[model samples]
Target: MLFRQFFDAESSTYTYLLASGRGREAVIIDPVKEQAQQYLTAIEQMDLKLVRAIDTHTHADHITALGDLRAATQCVTLMGEFTQAECVSDHVREDDIVDVDGIRLRALYTPGHTNESFSFVLQPERPEAVFTGDVLLIRGTGRTDFQGGDPHRSWDSITNKLFRLPEETIVWPAHDYKGWTASSIAEEKAHNPRLAGKTEAEYVDIMNNLNLPDPKMMDIAVPANLACGRG
Candidate 1:
C-alpha cells in the first residue's frame, strides 16, 4: 500500500492519505483545511485519484478539508453514522468496509473523545493498522470534557475495542505533540501511562481531573466542521 502522513502544526493534527499504489484510487482521513493544496499536490504527483474523504468526528481544533477536497476532486465526503456533520455525503456504520482499489478500511465505532468518534482499521482482513482519531494517542489520550466525551467510554473503547487488535498493528492517531509519529498496539498497551496497569476507576479519575482548557479554535472550528468546513 502507498501511505502518506501529513502534519498540521497549528493544531497538532495529522492527516493520512492511503492508496493501493500509484495511479490507484485513494482516500484521505482527518484532513486539515489549511493543508488541502499540499494533499492535492501529492495526489496529483502520485497519479492517484481522490475518491473519498473521511473525518472520524467533528473536530474542534482545526477546520476540515472535506468540503474543499470534494469541490476540487468530486470525491465523496464521509463520517461516522452518528456524526451530526450533515454535509457529509456518506456515513459508515460500525464494521462497514470502505474499499478503494483493493485498499480496505473497516470502520470501528470507538467513540470516546467524542460520541461520534471512530477508528478505521486498515486492511481489516489482516488488521495492519488503525487510524485512531484522537481516541487513542501516543502515550496519552484525548481529554473527555466536552462534545459528548466520557471518560468511561474512552476507557472501554481503548481497552475492549482497540486493544483487541493484533499486537503488531500500527496505531496512527489523529494528533501527536511529542514528535512521535506512530506506535504499535503492544507498545501502547505496555507503556501508555494512563492506560497501562491502571484500573478503570483510576483511569476515569485521571481523565476527570485533567482540567484541560478547551481548544483555542473550538468556537470556530466546531461550527465550521459541521458544514464540512465551509461555515
Candidate 2:
C-alpha cells in the first residue's frame, strides 16, 4: 500500500493520500482547499487515478478540497450521511465500505466533534490504521462546543468505539496544534490526559469549561464547506 500524509501549516490540518500502489486508484481524506494543486501534483506523480475525496464532517477551520478535487479529477466527494453538505457525491453511513481499487475504508460513525463526524478504518490490509478526523488527537480531543457537538457523545465515541480497536492501531487525527504526527490507540489510552482516567461526567465538565475561542475561519469556512468549498 502507498500512503502519504500532508500537512497544511495554516490550519494545522493533515490531509491523507492512500492507494494500494502506483497506477492504482487513490483516495484523499480531509483535504484542504489551499493544497488542492499540491494533492493533484502528487497524484499525477504517483500515476494514480483520484477516485474519491472524503471529509469526515463539515469543517469550521478551513475550506475543504473536495469540490476542487472533484472538479479536476471527477472524483466522488464523500461525507458522513448526517452531514448537511449538499454537494457531497456520496453520503456514507456506519459500516459502509469506501473502496478504491484494492483499498477499502470502513466508515465508523463516531460523532463528537460534529454531529456528522466519522472515523474511517482502513480494512483488510491495514485495519490497524484509522483516520480519526478530529475526534481523537495525539494527546487531546476535539472541542465539543458547537456544530451539534456533545461532550458525552465524544466520550462515548472514544471509550466505546475507538478504544475498542486493538492496542496497536494507529490513530491519524485531522489536526494537530503541536508538532506530533500520529499516535497509537494504546499510547493515547495510556497517556491522553483527557481520556486516561477520567469518568464520563468529569470529561463532560472539562470540555464544557474549556472556554476556547472559535476558529478564526469558522464563519467563512462553514458556509463555504456546505457548498463543498466553492467559496
Best by lDDT: 1
| Residue range 92-113, candidate 1, lDDT tens digits | 9999999989989999999789
TM-score winner among the candidates? 1
Candidate 2 contains a number of clashing pairs equal to 0
Off by over 4 Å in 2: 124-126
Q: What pairs collide in candidate 1?
A: none
The TM-score, computed over Cα atoms with residue i paired to residue i, of candidate 2 is: 0.98
- Residues 23-121 of candidate 2 have per-residue lDDT tens digits of 989999999999999999999999999999999889999999999999999999999999999899989989899989978999999988998899999
Q: What is the C-alpha RMSD of each candidate to the true structure, in Å?
A: 0.5, 1.0
Q: Which stretches of candidate 1 lie over 4 Å from their true place?
A: none
lDDT of each: 0.96, 0.94
Count backbone clashes in candidate 1. 0
